[model samples]
Structures are given as structure tokens and as C-alpha cells.
Target: MLQAGMHAFILALGLILPLGVQNLFVFNQGAAQHRFRQALPAVITASICDTILIGLAVLGVSVFLLKIVWIKTIFLLAGVCFLLYMGYVMWKSKPAVSEDEERIFSPKKQIVFAMSVSLLNPHAIMDTVGVIGTSSMLYSDMEKYVFTAVCMVVSWIWFTALAIIGKITGMADKSGRLLGMLNKLSAFVMWGMAILMLLSLR
Candidate 1:
């Protein structure tokens, strides 16, 4: 069980360490919020989405996804669309400076964007479904559950830490110029991801 847990932790960390639309959005929310707690919706939503994906992966749902090419294509297309829209939103967004309350993400917007980036992202889905799911097959029964739980726990911890880090950075950037640059960079990342997905469809 300990071995399974450790394996899952390492694998989950590897999968999540890369920069992506989901990670950027969560970090951006952390930086944009007036308080750390205000960023909870994004972190919580993302963690929940990842938990669900990991759970399904362990249950062999990825096998179902692989056997259905059309379903995968549909998911990818929707993901690309959302990523593009998100990029536009990010490009136009201003930091949540005291004078620009309108720039901040409300709880509802946080939930929606968090869900879109997490659930609609085919790259993330495939990593969870292909890498984590395939890795989980190495275990059985109680060990399998332990592996799944560990992966979920790691994801939760990761998002929480990421937000905390972002909050720290936000606090430091009193002028908001750094955050402005970050927003533009995030837009590029989102658009790049979308283009990659579109190209893959070829």
C-alpha cells in the first residue's frame, strides 16, 4: 500500500507539474483576488474536477474513451474553443487593483472558468486517463483505491499550494505591472494550447 501510494504520488506530480491553461487560470485567480480565501473557488473546483477525472481513470473509463474516437474528437474541439475564448478574456483582463474592482473574477465566473479549463481540457484528460489510468492498472483491490486516493490528495495539495504562491506574488506586485505581463503571457499559453489541439486534429 505504501508503495502504491508513493508511486501514485510521483506519477501525479509528474503529470501536473507542467504549465497549462488550468494551472495558469488558478494562479491568475489567486493573484486577482483580494484575499486568499476568495481564490478558494478556483482551487476547489479544479481539485474536484481532477479528483473526478482520476477516479474515472482508475475505474477504466479511459478505455471507453479510447474505443470511441468521435467522443475524443468532440472533447478536443470543445476544449480548443474554450481555450480560445479564455485566452481572449485573459488578454483583455486587467489586474484586480483597488481601482479596478470590475477586473476581479466573481465566484460564479471562477467556477465556470475553472470547470471549463479542468473538464474540457483534452490534454489533461489524456494524461490522467492514459498515464494515471494505465499506472493504476498495476495495482488491485485495496491497493488500487489507495493509489487513487493518493493521486487525488496530491492534486488537492498542489492546487492549494499554487494559489498560495500566486497570492504571495500578487501581494508583492503593488504596481500591478508584473501581473499585467502575466496576464498577457497566460493568454499566449491558452492560445498556444488551443492551436496545438487543433493541429492534432489533422
Candidate 2:
């Protein structure tokens, strides 16, 4: 159970750290408003997908994923690099004080964009489905449920806070300093996570 929990947490961190890079950039570009508004539908969709993958893991899908050694390694490495690059982007990014706010705030576009980003992203699939689901298989059904519940709660808290903050603070205007800091912090987190994952691979 302890091992399963650790695996789930690590996998979640691995997946989320990279995803955060892309999201934060969009956030800095003032797309956060769009993202926040569309977050509800996007998050809901992601949750359902994650739940299904986790269920499959409980049914022994993880073993299949684990066997694809090269694929897992490739994804793991790619996820790490993507995060580091995103961090770099954030570090160099300035706040979006654009004059075209009205043009970019379409609800349907936002929701569709959110869905596409979260759903089609290979890194996300690997983390939630391959890593977390695979790890969850180490434990019994009860423990797997507990682990999944914890991970979902984590996802909910993160996305909710991000959307709310983006809406309230207006990432376009007053979030430059805050966004800069977040980018740096996210970069460090990603670098650390990547290193840890590499170590585990060896």
C-alpha cells in the first residue's frame, strides 16, 4: 500500500509538472481567463478518463505498459524535458497586457482548447494511465481506491485554485510578478522530479 501510494504521488507529480508548464504559459499569455472558464468541462472530462484508466490498471493493464520498456523510458524522459523547457519559457515570459482581450475570450474555443490539451496530451496519458494506474496495481482494490481518490482530490484542488486565481487576479494585468515566481518554482519542481525519475529508471 505504501509503495502504491508513493508511486501514485510520484507519477502524478511527474505528469502534472509538465502539464503545468504548458498551462502556465497559456496563463501568462492571458489565456488563463479562457482556461479558467473552460476548466469545469475540461476537468470533468479529464477526471472521467483518469478514472477509467485507473480502473483498467486495477484489472492488470499496468503490466502491459511496464513491458514496453523503451516506450516508458522515452515518455519519462520526454515529460521531464518538456517541463524544463516550459520552466524556461515561464522564466522569460512577461505578463500579457494585451489590447485584444475581447477577441480571445470565446467560451467554446476555450473549452475545446482545454479538452484538446488535456485529453490528447501523451504526457497526461502516460502519467494518469500508465504510471499511476500501473502503480495502483501493486495493492488491493481498497488500497487502489484510496490512492485514486487521493490523486483525484489533488487534481481537483490544483485545477480549481488555478482557474479561480486566474479569474480573480486577471493574469493579463496584475499577475506578472506572481506568474514569474510561479514559473521559476515550477521549473525547479520539474527539474527535481525529472532527476528523481531518472534515478528510478536506473
Candidate 3:
């Protein structure tokens, strides 16, 4: 159980360390919101979505989904379009002078976007299905439970930490220049990821 837990933790940490769309969205919300509490909805929504994906992957549902080529293709195309749209929106966004001026997404909006980024993003789905799901094949029964639990825990902790980091940075940047720069970088990163996804589709 210990070994399985450790393996799950390490694997999840490695997979999540990348600056992906979901992480970027969470970080951006943390930085844009007036208070850390205001970003909780996004943080919680993203973590829950990941938990669901991880659970589905461990159960082999993702594997079945992958067996259908058209489903994968459709998901990939949708993910690319969503990423490109998000990038364009981020690129055009203006820096807010203060928290009050920042465009805060309602809880429903945050949930929708978070769900889309987690469930609709083909890369995220593949990572869960391919990496976490594959790794779970090495464990069984209680060990498998431990592995899944550890992975889910790691995800929750990592996202919380990410939001905290963003909040701290937001607090420090009174002039919002840093936030503006981050938004631009996020836009480029999203576009780059979309392009990579497109290339993979070819």
C-alpha cells in the first residue's frame, strides 16, 4: 500500500506540474479575484473534475472511450477550438486597475469553464486515461484504492497550492502589470498547446 501510494503521488505530481490549461485557468482566477475566498469555486470545481476523471480512468472507462477512434477525434477537435478561443479572449483582456475592476466570473461560469477544461480537453483526458489508468493496472483491490486516493489527494493539494501562489502574486502586484504579463503568457501558452494538439491530430 505504501509503495502504491508513493507511486501514485509521484506520478500525479509529475503529470500535474505542467502548465496546462486547467492550471492556468485556476491560477488566473486566483490572481483576478478580489480575495482568495472568491477563487474557491474555481479551485474546488477543478479539483472535483479531476477527481471524477481519475476515478473514471481507474475504472477503465477511459480505456473503453479510447477504443473509439471517432470519439477521440471529436474530443481533440473540440479541445483545440476551445483552447484557441480561450487564448484569443485572454489576449484581448485588459488589466484591471483593482480587484473591483476585474471581471469576476460567476460560480456557474467558473464551473462550466472548469468542467470544459478538465473534461473536454483531450490532453487532460488522455493523461488520466493513459498514465493514471495504465499505472493502476499494477495494483489491485485495496492497493488500487490507495493509489487512486493518493492521486486524487495530490491533485487537490496541488491545485490549492497553485491558487495560493497566484493569490500571493496578485497581492504583490498592485499595479496589475504582472497580472497583465501573466495573461499574455497564458494566451501564448494556450495557443501553443492548441497548435500541438492540432499537429498531433495530423
Candidate 4:
């Protein structure tokens, strides 16, 4: 499990870039703070499904997965494109929603939208199934499961912390310049992740 901890550490490190900045953007938007929190249900939901898939991979599902050449290619291309689009979105995105805007934002719809975003996202697949799944190779059967669980929990903890911090710090307040800086940082990370994914494919 030592390796598992290391794996989690590394994955968490990557996440600090994209997820951290993205959370900051979400917080700033105020259009979806409550909705983002509601999205936790979806994030955890996706994490659980990913954990199951990872577990299967460690048990030799990779053999079956490997048989399909298109899967990897598809994901690689999709992930690269998705990251680029995310970069563009962050780069072009405007101000955090004001109180009046928040008043009109519906938490229920936001939660569903957040869930869809998590589910449809190619980056999530690469992170959880590709990275975390491969990391499982470093351990035994029992340890692999334990590691998967830890990784899933880490994702949940990270997102929850981001949401809570954004809400509490008033860091998303429209008046603050910090919010803009955070979004720019998010755009950079998105671009970085795109480049990294593209390189990994080659």
C-alpha cells in the first residue's frame, strides 16, 4: 500500500492543477455554487463507477480492453479535444455571477448538469481509469482494491474541500480580482493537461 499512497499522491498532485483551478472557476461563477455542492453526489457516483472499472482492470480486464484498439485511440483523441475546449472555455469565460444572478440559478438543474459534466468528460476517464487503473499494477489484489478506494476518496475529499473553501472564503466574490486570476490559472492547467494527454498518446 506504500505504492498506493504514492500513486494517490501523484494523482492528487495532477488534480491540484486542473480540479483546483476549475473549482475556483465554479466558485466564482456563483451561478452554481450550491449546484456544484449538489454535484458531489454525481462526482462520487462517477468515482464509484470508476473504482469498479479499475478493480476489473486489475483483475485482467485490461486484456479484454487491450484487444480493442479503438478504445484507447478514441479516448486519447477525445481527451485531448476535451481539454483544449475546456481551456478555451476558461480563457473566454466571463465574471462570477452576482447575487441577483444566483437568485435565479436553480440548484436542482445545476446538480444534474454537474453530474452530466462529470460523466461525459473524457479527462475523468483518463484520470481515473487510465492513470489510477495503471497504478494498480504496482500492488497485489487486496492492495489494489484498497488503493482504488483511497483514490476515489481522495477525489471526493478534494472536490468537497474546493467547494467548501470557495463558499467560505468569499473568494468568489465578484469584487475580488483573485477570482479572475484563479480562472486564468485554470485555463493554463487545462492547456497543460491537454498537452500532457496528447504527448502521452504519442
Structural similarity to truth (TM-score) of each candidate: 0.97, 0.52, 0.94, 0.60
Give the runs in model 1 whose Cα sits over 4 Å from its true position: none
lDDT tens digits, residue span 3-109, model 3: 99999999999999988888988998887787888788889999999999999999999889877989888888998888898888778775555655546766787
What is candidate 4's local distance difference test score? 0.56
lDDT per model, in order? 0.92, 0.55, 0.87, 0.56
Once all C-alphas are superposed, what RMSD does model 2 give against the true structure? 6.7
TM-score of 3: 0.94
Cα deviation at 126, candidate 2, in Å, is 2.3
- lDDT per residue for candidate 1 within 1-202, as digits (tens), equals 9999999999999999898888899998998899999999999999999999999998988669856989989988999999999999999998877857789898999999999999988878888989999999999999999999999999999999999989999999988898899899999999998999999899
Worst 10 residues of 2 by lDDT: 25-34
lDDT score for residue 171 of model 3: 83
In model 4, the clashing pairs are none
> Which pairs, if any, clash in model 3?
none
Q: Give the best candidate by TM-score.
A: 1
Question: Is candidate 3 or 4 superior in TM-score?
Answer: 3
Per-residue lDDT tens digits of candidate 4, residues 1-202?
Answer: 7777667666745754465334543444342344455445434444455455555545667446545778866766765676577567666654445544543324554344344344334555545556666767778776776776776666656656655666554444646456556667767876786777677666
lDDT, model 1, position 101: 72
Off by over 4 Å in 4: 1-53, 60-67, 100-147, 171-174
Stretches of candidate 3 exceeding 4 Å from the true structure: 99-102
